[model samples]
Target: MKKFSLLSNRAGALFLAPGAILVALFVIIPFFWVIFVSFTNRTLLGRTAVNPDFVGLQNYLALFNPETFFTRGQFGFSLILTTQFVILSALVGQALLGLLLAWLMQAVPKPLKAFTETCVIAAWILPEVVIGFAWFAFLDYDNGTLNGILRSIGLPGADLLLQQPFWVIVFFNTWRGAAFSMMLFNSAFQSIPPSYFQAADVAGATSFQKFRDIALPLIRGHVVTDLILITMWTFNVFTPFILTHGGPSYRTELLSIYTYRVAFKDFEFGKGAAVGVIIMLINLAFALVYLRIARSRNKEAEQ
Candidate 1:
């Protein structure tokens, strides 16, 4: 029995070793390295050149200075804009729409459900660059499909890309990403027993009431998981860089774009690392909030 157990333990470690090594190599090591780099005055060129000196929190201080952060077209504004984009596009747009689609799918016929699932999955699996280019063409000013439709209907077509760049990107991200959330919710909903819904119907509960009282409570865990995943993904997304290029005077320049500009474009490696640290902290904050909410929901469900 001892010999057999030893072999089983060795087999389990073999399966787990690959994933553990990859995480340490990619996620864990890089996370601390970025933090270490943030405290040094690193530069790709000029006097600092090859060797970087320790500057403590100078990079952070400079980044958060009154003029730098508060200025209309600066780091502070970029952070604020990115927050808005994540909240609206990921939290509200994708989460709400995906949940609705999942609920709607429950009542859809099998044929329609399969077709819709295929379409949604197709969108989800397509390359991010392809989605960006597709949206770019769809929203182009003059000869785009959207403008063509507007002109056919005797309406004046405006340059949505230039006029509403931020919202356009938000909508674009939501459309491309909602399919994941929808599939997640669908899976969660499937695990729910139908007896609860039947009981609610027998009690003469309305659809909204049933959803609020039954589905919401049961799917709380999945909702929390889906939101955290989408929020992080949306916050860090660089796909819109292909579409908007963070252009139109930096109006849609998210924090990730801002970090890229400061680090690579400006050759200020230290400041960029500081920005990277800040974004990491922000993501950490989101994860904490999600975990707290999930914990509370779990406690309530247990009671």
Candidate 2:
């Protein structure tokens, strides 16, 4: 029995070795490399670009020091704007609207449910660039479908994307990603025992009350998971590059776009790596919260 047990353990380790190696080489190594580069004076235009010298915390300090041009307020604005985009578009727009749509599907006829779900899933499955272009055409100022319809109806055509770039990107992101949240909530809501809702209905619970009391409590785990995952993705999203190009006075420039501009466009690799590290730390904080919620939820389930 001991020999068999030892063999089983060895076999399990062998089976997991490849996956562990892959993670280390791809994910873990790159993560630490980025952090290391942040402390260097790397720049594509410099003579030492091929072998950049270490600069301690100069890159990070530059992000905080107002004396440095980049750190003045542009990066701060991008950070704040990115936070707003995550909250408004991913958390409120996608998660809330997805839940509502999922709930609505429950009361709709089967054919309608299928149709609505198909439409949403279709949008979700489309490539990001394709979705961006679709929205680009949809929100185009001149000779676009939306403005054309408005003009036909005697209303003056307006350039929505140009005037409200931030909100336009938010709406676009929500429309593109809401289907994921909807599918997640749909699966979670299904796992919930129907008897809970039946009992709530019998006890004179209003629709909102039932949702607030029963649905929300039962699916709190899913909510946390979805929020964290979506928030991280939305925070790192660069889809606005296609739609807005971080232009019209940089109103919609996200942290990801800022990092790209710094590294690739501006050729300041060290500063870009610093911004990347900051973004990673923010996501790590979110991941910790997610793990805590998941652990507590697991404990509750076990009990």
Best by lDDT: 1
Best by TM-score: 2
TM-score, prediction 1: 0.87
lDDT on C-alpha atoms for all candidate structures: 0.90, 0.88
Q: Which stretches of candidate 1 lie over 4 Å from their true place?
A: 1-22, 289-303
- TM-score of each candidate? 0.87, 0.90
Tens-digit lDDT track of model 1 for 171-208: 98898899999999999889999999999999999888
Ten contiguous residues with the weakest lDDT in model 2 = 65-74
Candidate 2 global lDDT: 0.88
